[model samples]
Target: MRFGYFLSCEEYSPAELIEQAVAAEKAGFDGIWISDHFHPWNDEQGESPFVWGMIGALSQACSLPVTTAVTCPTTRVHPAIVAQAAATAAVQLQGKFVLGVGTGEALNEHVLGDAWPSEDIRLEMLEEAVELMRRLWSGEVVTVRGEHYDLDTARIYTLPDEPVPVYVSAFGPKALEVAARIGDGFINTSDDADTVREFKEKSGGKPCQGGVKVAWADSKDEGIDHAHRLWANSGLPGELSQVLPSPKHFEQAAQLVTRESTAESIVAGNDLDAHVEQMRSYVDAGYDEVYVANMGPHYLAMIEAYGRDVLPQLRG
Candidate 1:
């Protein structure tokens, strides 16, 4: 499986993200996955830069292929706007960009005062958005009056030689079905073999990608501490992540998440064996690519370690 580095916009500044992307390339990572968020999951994570701008800067900084871990085109931003931005990014990256999209969460999508839609409605919106984007990417004047969006006589002037690939993110059956129907590829955050197999079967063997977070520090305890402090929300159960409307609510909910749970859920510290095993899980589950994100302040160290020790082991 191909290995990539995940750039967390929630935790690092734009400059730090650029530095990490450069480090990741030098570290022998194959590509990059950048999160698109309007706010940090909580205040402790601290930063969220405009993802499009970061993609622009990234194109100049590194030759690595880049994918937005997922962007929501149905809300906060219109599909037309997302398509234009993505096309521009594709051109900037010389067609090495993939637009990974999802129905999105209330945390980022509701900031425009738009009421968050239910799962079914959100899925419907995503389908329509994908259709709109693909049409726009055709480099032809497109006019559409659709269920979730309306487009006037619009055309993307700046275009890549090939259309940007759209990878759909899904964590449930309904979303998975939608993804299989519309996406060029599939994306998930977990290494669930059944889900990956199901998508591949339905999508005629489309590529699947997975992402995992690890906290790399000098010791296991330090890593756990950092993971708990910054990403405890990751442990919250069920639909809490999708429904919670703000960082404050996430912080309130994350209060119930324990450091032990964070340690259990996230691979922590300098255990190269554990890191390799975690990544291998995705491969074993049938993922074509896996991206790893480092939590806390020691990301540079983590990147270097992965290059020198972990990645070589995974390859072997």
Candidate 2:
């Protein structure tokens, strides 16, 4: 399995993100995955730069292939606009871009003041959006009058030689079905063997990508502290993440997430063995590629250490 770095737009400034990308390339990461968010998960995480602009900057900064770990093109942004932006990014990256999309969460999408739809409705919108974006990428003028969206005489002028691959992010059966039908690939955040196997089986062997978050600091305690403070929401149960409407709501819910839970859930500190084990779970689970994100201030050290110790062992 290939290993890549995940740049968290929700956590880092644009300059820090670009620096990390460059460092990741130097550290021998295979590619890059970037989060697309309008708001940080909570105020503590502290930044959310426009992902499209960052993609453009990354294209100019490094040769690493980049995938938006997931973007929601169905709501805050129109699929037509996503199509144009993705096409331009692919061209800038010389066709090394993958548009990873999803049904989206209220945290980011509700900003436009639109009512958050149910999961089924959101899935339908995603299906329609994906279809419309694909049509737009063909470089032909297109018109559509669909249930969720409409297009009139719209055509993408700046196109990549090949259509941008749309990887669908799914966490459940219904979403998986839509992913198999529409996605060029599959994306998920956990090291879930059953889900990965099911997606591949249903999709006829398309690539499956997964992502994990870790905190690296001087000691396990320090790492746990960072993870708890910044990403405790990651431990929330059910659809709470999908339904929480703002950073404040997320913060309110995350208060229920204790440091012990964060410690148990997140790989922490400079224990190379622990880090390797977490990543290997994704590999063993049948992911084609896995992206890793650092959750604290020691990101530079984390990347360098991965290059020096963790990556070599994994490759071996």
Candidate 3:
């Protein structure tokens, strides 16, 4: 399976992220996935760099392809804008960029103060949004009036050698179906084989990528503490995924996930078997590729260990 790094675009400056991208490429990572958030999921995690600008800069500095962990075109930003931005990035990258998108998070979408739509509405909006983007990319005068959007004399003429691939980031059945039917590929991070299986069955034979975060340290306790401090909320079983109105709301929900919770959420320790088991779950579930995120201050060590200590054994 292919491996890549997942960057939060928080807790790191643009220069730092670009450096990380370079490091990841040097480490033989296949791709890079960057998060798109107006704010960190929580205040504890400060900094959310402008997503497009960062991607553009990284494209110039890194050899590996980059994808937005997930951008939503339906509400927070118009799909047409996303298409145009992606088109520009595609040309700049010489075709090393793919637009990874999702229905969206309240953390980002609530900025407009529009009532958060239900899952069905969000899915419906996604369909219309992607359709709009695809239409706009043709460089044709697309005068489309849909339930969610209306475009007139819309066209994108500066497309690169080809259309940028669109990958859907999905979490459930209905969203999974949408990803399968429309997306060029699928992106997820459930670490649950069953979730991937359900997604693939609907994803129309599209390629799939999953991101798994691992904290590597000389001691397991240190690793666990690091994971807890940074990503404990990921353990909330869909915390703020639907309920939070904004990053502020997410911050509130995340406060519940303490170090004890982190121990439960993540696969702790340097146990080769545990890591392998985590990786196996994704592979067995039909993920075409897996991106592993090394979460900790000692990211360099994590990468070294993966290469020098973990890879040979996994391959063997």
Candidate 4:
């Protein structure tokens, strides 16, 4: 299985993220997954730079393939614009980029003052968006009058030799069906084996990607504190994350999230055995790639540790 580092745009400065991308490549990571967000999940995480600009920096700094963990082409950005941006990124990355698309969360899309559509409507929009983007990527002059989007003679000139692969993100059965119908690959954050299997079954055995967040520190307790402080929003119940309108709302919901909840959700501490075991869960689940995000301040150390210890054992 391929191993990647998840660059949390919400947690790091643009320069720091770029540096980490370079470091991650040197430290034996196979690829990079960067979060595409307009706002951080919580105010404390505090940084969300334009992901496209950073992707350009990454292209210059490292050779590792990059993917937006998931971008919502249906809402905040029009599918036509996303097609253009993705086509440019693929060319810049020398065809080493994947456009990971999803139905999207309100936290980012709601900022445009558009009403948050229901799941059914979002799914419909996502299907149409993917279809439209693919058409544009093919160097076709797309003129569409769809239910959710409208386009007029859109064309992408700066495209790679081949169209960029699009991986759709899904957590539920309905979403998985959408991914199966349109995606070149499938992506999810959970390590649930059954869910992965279900996705594979639906997608006709397309490539599957998984992402996990971990906190590595001198002690497990320290890691737990860090995870709780910076990533508590991750543990919030389902649907809440998708519907929450603002980072402030996310922070409010996160108030009830405890340190123990973080410990359960996130792998923590410097124990090589534990970290390896956490990653093994994804590998055993038939994930083609598993991306790990270091949830604390000391990402450099985490990169070195994974390079020195975790990655080597995983190879064996």
lDDT of each: 0.95, 0.96, 0.79, 0.92
Lowest lDDT sum, 10 consecutive residues, model 2, at 255-264
Pull out the clashing pairs in model 1.
none
In the order shown, the candidates' Cα RMSDs to the true structure are 0.6, 0.5, 2.0, 0.8
Candidate No. with top lDDT: 2
Q: Over the stretch 236-304, how does candidate 3's per-residue lDDT look in tens digits?
A: 665356567655676677677778878866766677667777777777777877777766677776666
Q: Which tens-of-lDDT digit does each residue in 1-316 have in candidate 1?
A: 7999999999999999999999999999999999999999999999999999999999999999999999999999999999999999999999999999999999999998999999999999999999999899998999888888988999999999999899999988999999999999999999999999999999999999899999999999999999999999999999899999999999999999987788889899999999989999988999999999999999999999999999999899
Error of 2 at 28 (Å): 0.4
- Please provide TM-scores, in order, for all candidate models, with all chains considered together: 0.99, 0.99, 0.92, 0.99
- Candidate 1, which segments miss by more than 4 Å at Cα? none
Candidate 4: tens digits of C-alpha lDDT, residues 148-243: 899887788998999889999987889988898899999999888998888788878999999999899999899999899998999898799999
For candidate 2, write residues 205-313 as lDDT tens digits: 9999999999999999999999999999999999999999999999999989889988989899999999999999999999999999999899999999999999999
Name the better of 1 and 4 by lDDT.
1
Q: What is the model-wide C-alpha lDDT for candidate 3?
A: 0.79
For every model in order, what is the number of clashing pairs? 0, 0, 1, 0
Q: How does candidate 4 fare on TM-score?
A: 0.99
Candidate 4: residue 172 Cα off by (Å): 1.0
